[model samples]
Target: MQALQSRLQQLENATGSDIWNILKGSESDLIQDLSTLNTLKEDKEKKGREALKVLETKKKELKSLKKEIETLRNEYKLHVEEVEKGLKASGLEMSQVTKVFEKVLEDSLSEKKTKILQIISSMRDFKTIPELHSPLKSILELLKDPNQEKLRSMIQIDLEDIHRQSMEIFRQNLWSEFQKQGIPMKKLQETPNPDEFLQRVSRIFEFSSDLDLLLIGIPNNRIHVAFGMLSNICIDMIENEKERDADFEWILTSAHKWAKNLREVIEKATERTGSEFDEKFVEFIGNITKRFLKKNQKDPLIFTKLATLLRRFEDTCEFNLTDKDIFESLYEPEFISKWILLEIELFTLSFNQLLLDSSSFDPLPSIFIGSASSSTWASEITVQFEQWISRVEKDISSIRNPEVQTTFYECLYALMIDLCSKIHVEANRLYSEASWSNHVYLVMNTIWELRRIVKVFIFITNRERDRRGKKKDIELAGELKWPRENSFLKEN
Candidate 1:
């Protein structure tokens, strides 16, 4: 707007000048009016000729003043032209900038005011504006101070500082304000939220697309700052949204999609410097593992979820496939492999407790005499297994190597054996026919259920072995101790 006003004023000053038109015919007008003096008597025409002479002098002064103003106007026009070109080169849309500036600086505007307003016009769409130091500085430097440098100095802006402030504002405030129409307040950070989360999340990616289109050629130092700012904001927002009652793994899985959007923006903005940006998120992953580990010191099912969480990072973060596995996995392959190894250990530990619990090994006919309410021990164990294994199967999609998959299956096989052995011991201890049939039915049912689950471990491990061309000399079910029909006390 300021630019248009400046331009309109410039066009008016250039074309609406009657002084230039008068100057172009001044000599003829002066000659025609003074010609009567040549025909008159010398004494009588002298005063008229002197009056004409004085009028001609004033006209010459006006002409000189007009020329000087024209020169300044021409200089200002050249400056505006150059700035518009710079805007185009910088990938900023001049048409949009013009419209935006026209609306913003409509009242207080000048040709010199157009440049920064053009850069800042992007504010309507996003909080963060592209780096404006170069274009703004260049344009300001080109401008001639209208108030003898007083007003110019007062209005002098540090575009870098403004850029920083805009980004910080975004970081400090939650994005929910912009997304009020999106995720319902009741559903925020809750389950059945992926769909809503995705709607808001897609905007970040779309925001990324806009950043990629920026004509901003900020310095490498500025690029680093951008990446750092964005990375920190991502970590902070995702962390701040931690919902205590919601599923931990589910929140992280959803959070990772947003993080990936930030990552893509940083990668695009930083280019060669993206490694530093990419590595920063590794710290977030490491922190999640540490937090989960501290919380799971006594919880049995957490390791499976923890392992799953780490595996999610490994898949999305681009950890290498050939590297040796570790107890810590992340964007860093070494650490990621290490994390995976730790998860496998935790997985093994959890199952060992699940399957080898001595309480399940009690073998007595008295176990059948208790009311249905009194003997919920086996049902409780089965319920826990059902809740756990379903989650385990669903969340470990990040496991890349076939060997790692086999290790987990082997652990499951071992667990199946431990559980089956305990049930077998209990089944052999029943005395009377009614008690034996009743308790034995329960024990055999437990064994068969475990066997069916072991079959999955069998199918996975055997298939993996085939893919690797390993000798299929061993059977998964045989190793897991499939219940052979050796009658315990001849079913008596």
Candidate 2:
């Protein structure tokens, strides 16, 4: 019993040193106590049984303590791991910067704002926008310390407010500067020296690039500001040009220059932001063209010039298009229909003027003594019809769309038939019986020439359709429901 008591005293002393360091020593002492308890178990004395029971109780207690120490150790390990993870996430390490940050947190709001502005200004030179947030994140981490909880809340709120106000003021100043640096599309157009205008454009591009770099902290700020400024400049130019009734060529050239240059800028601005400007630009152009079209619907040259300009713009800007689409897919079939009808109206007007200028179809009674072949003799109307057919062919050849060509050809066929009917009626009324046969030959000759012209146009139109892989039949004379005389020429 004295030996057991001695061992117990030793175990207690060992345990008192340090629980972590004494666990193994305490276990060794417990093992010796177990050996002594086993040796004393056979004594069969009351003190022996009591000693055995006491040893058993002590063993239970020590086992329980071991479990508790193990649980505490595991908990400590987890706590250390969590602290390491938090430090890593905060982009900070155990360093003296924490003490410095503590002092910064104690500064006045104005002083803090100044410091933040200085940090931001310095960080603006960072290679990437995301990298600029590193220093700010470190500041945030220092602010998150639980020791400065109240101070953290107050300072964070103040910093946020300061940042918001500063960003707004900064953005406005940058915007004002950007506006001043930007040369409007109208001014660029009016600039007679192409080299000077190009230099100004280069300067604008450089400014846009610098603005993008300066506004790195605000995501997409540069994109919005630059796009807005360009939008306003283009809109202003459109309004000014419309008011002045400027030539379509001028409007188109100016629009093209802006679009080509701004496209590259928009691409660069949106590249890092993962935002799209294509739809926005397309919508912008749609609106501007809509306004221009509304104002110049009566202008005869708008159709051809607008078509050429939009095709070039679409190609240069990488705008999507299908076979049936044109003008960056902005204008639809309805617009093309209007253009076709306008062209037919103009053709009719010109044809009417031609008739007015040379009203007589018969040969004048001029005494020409030169002998001529009677078979080769042709009326002035036949010559006029041939010349008119050549002009019509030239105009139609300039049209690229096969469907539009087919539609125009059909309308023109109807027009020719109506005009021929009138010519037949007029000839019957004016010619005497003696000249009736000659007049008939001359009229038939004109009809024959018109028939040849119609065949040639059909062949050309069908060949175009075949080239486009369209199998739809276009019977210009027979299949089409021809409009009444002069009815198709009316405004829709």
Candidate 3:
């Protein structure tokens, strides 16, 4: 319409006065069209008002209907409760009903009874079911027949008698086995070679004793007897070996191998040997440990022996076992795994004792233990530390054991055990976390370098590599882990 009006104006502008007169003549008709649109607008407003009133009336009806429905629902609920009460008063018990029977078979009592019996029969380890007694009593009472009171009493009496008789027989069998096999371990040292003796004892434990079952089973006197035998034998074999005391390395290596093998064999046996025997071999392990400690506690070289014994074992553990027969080697067939931790306990005790004995360290010159220079406590202990390392180097230099040479960690361990003892004492006495942090670092610095000093005697680590490379980088390998600067102040 706008386009038409614009075209008419363009015609008046181009064609002159006649087109302008015609456009003026159509203005009244345009006014009449606008008036007709206004009349239609009033009519639409009147119809919309009427529709809104009708919608409001319908909403009121819906609300009234909703109220009536809620009233009906409440009445239905009350009726359901009344019906349920009547049914319950007529001797119904929904609580006793099993969900399966109620849902699937419509609460069949016979089906529930069969299911309940299945549940009761499935329970094992009868002593564990004491908590179920009340429920069982309730179920039985529901199904009780007063007429069978005498029959039930008779069955209970018979069961009690049978249980008593069974237990008596079991006890007798245990005692009989104990009598035949629970004697002290026979002399395992017929041969000077310890391996054969170890094997013989292992055989006695395996075939005659059911040791795996015994270890998992109850421990009685027989178990103690077995442990006593193993302990006695282990300590004796090591302590009394021909020329073994002379060669400390050989004794340590043998101890390492035997302890590892024993632990392995015993672990494998106990893992799957789930027999119901009466006694555990772990207690025997404890006995072996006790005897070992008692026999060797007084030896001057006890700590070194204990340390060396475990050091070889620890070194062997660090290397990965790539061979398929590794387990077989450690836990060899028939020989029970020897307990290593027992010797480890002795080692720890010896170490702690060594730590507490300040006298073992050279006497510090007159001042406090923290100050060694100017005749202070520090100077004398440092002197002792040097002397101790010098002795260790001499000792390690004399090693004839090929195995000791082969495993260098054992050599390193030898250095650490004594070095750690000095540090342990000084750190506990002279330096603590609250007191003199820098001085603690000062003490630690000297202690750390002891390793480098010892390395010259037995350049066991990276010696070949350094020789092959032929460079000054060998110094890098020997550098001690110096204390970080944050905590330390060196005396100028």
Candidate 4:
């Protein structure tokens, strides 16, 4: 029995040893798995930190680029503004210079050649006006001479003096201003052309204005003095026959420049007053137009100036034809007859100028007639008719004089009828002459439009008359009823 118990104990010991081995194996595997998990976590954290560092660096670079772009935009804006201001100032300076140049030309032309040369030489170290008077007196005496050759030679010599004196004065004035402002006059003088000089002067002027209103303090007398100088130059140009072509081109170019300068000055003045000028503004324009007409009467450029003046006054002119008074003054039957004749005369003039073959009325009709599909002129005419209709309707209630009202209505009716008939005849002629192209179709369509406009005018007139007649009938009936009631009361 004891031997059997020892064998059973040995079997129990073997089973315990197997279980301990299995437990140790399980513990080792668990430790290995935990170590692998810890290593992976450490690697992940390190990579995340490195990626964050890279993002921060990229963000800072983007910010730097943004700031640089903003700085560049600001710098560019300032540069452009500076450039524009300079251009405006240069224009003003050139105007003043031109005026002074003109005066010099006039003085030179009026004086004797040797005397003028002496005066110019004296001006080299000019200290006083008295120093110039001796030479000036001598030149005045030479003007009494009647010899053409002597006169011509004397004038040429005087012109050279004038050019020299004018240039010296311009240079001195420009140099003084440049020095005071700390601008480089030498650089400006080195500029190749007038345009370049103008640009530089403009820039300087803009800078000056920004620094202070240095240009605004000039006296009224000074402005007139400048104008006088320019006037003298213009006279010289007109009188001098030797430099006709060169002078003409110069005058034209200078006049254009002067006009531009005047416009800029006016604009600046108005801007200072918040873009509103007084009645003096109108007077100023009128003065300019008068001067332009007087100076350039026969020049083709006069047409351009006249057209501009008309445009300026277009908004203010009494062009509405519906008001009885306006219609009577502008387009009564007598006036209409005169105007139509005048238009015909003008049309004939245009035809003569074109040297058109008028044997067939084709050219004449083409000029007056417009297309329907793309005719801007037709559109304008249509709008004008519409405006007349509106004005008639608006003024109908205010019309007091029966004769005047009748005159307006009749004039309007006649005008519309005449225009429509003319268009219809022209359209018919065109259709007969040619197969209907887009242009012919447009002409036919315009005739139809004119017919519609005339019909509308007739309808408006009839409707207005009917309304007034009904109101009159109501008033008449009330009067009759009152009289009948009064008679019954008296009888009782």
lDDT of 2 by residue, 221-293 (tens): 4445545666666566666773434654465556556654555544443334332444455555666676667
List the global CA lDDT of all models: 0.48, 0.54, 0.43, 0.44
Q: Which stretches of candidate 4 lie over 4 Å from their true place?
A: 1-219, 235-253, 256-292, 295-446, 449-492
List, residue by residue over 1-492, the lDDT tens digit for candidate 3.
Answer: 454475567575555676776667666765766777788988999999999999999999999999999999999999978866876898765454345345554334445455445534543233322333343444344334333343234344433343333333333443333233322221223224445444534433333232222122323322334334345555666567555345544533544344334334333333332221112332333333344444554554543453454345435542232322111211221211121233334345654565565443433445342324432333344454445445444333333333333333343354455445445446555554565566555555455444444454336434633543422223322333333343222221
Ranked by lDDT from best down, the candidates are 2, 1, 4, 3
| Deviation from native of the Cα of residue 39 in model 2, angstroms | 78
Candidate achieving the largest lDDT: 2
Give the TM-score of each candidate: 0.36, 0.43, 0.25, 0.23
Give per-candidate clash totals. 16, 0, 14, 5
TM-score-based ranking = 2, 1, 3, 4
User: What would you estimate as the lDDT of candidate 4?
Assistant: 0.44
The candidate 2 region of ten consecutive residues with least summed lDDT is 479-488
Using TM-score as the measure, which candidate wins? Answer: 2
lDDT tens readout by residue for model 1, 192-250: 54455455444443333333322244333333333344344434544555453236565
Q: For residue 453, what is the lDDT in candidate 1?
A: 53
Cα deviation at 193, candidate 4, in Å, is 20
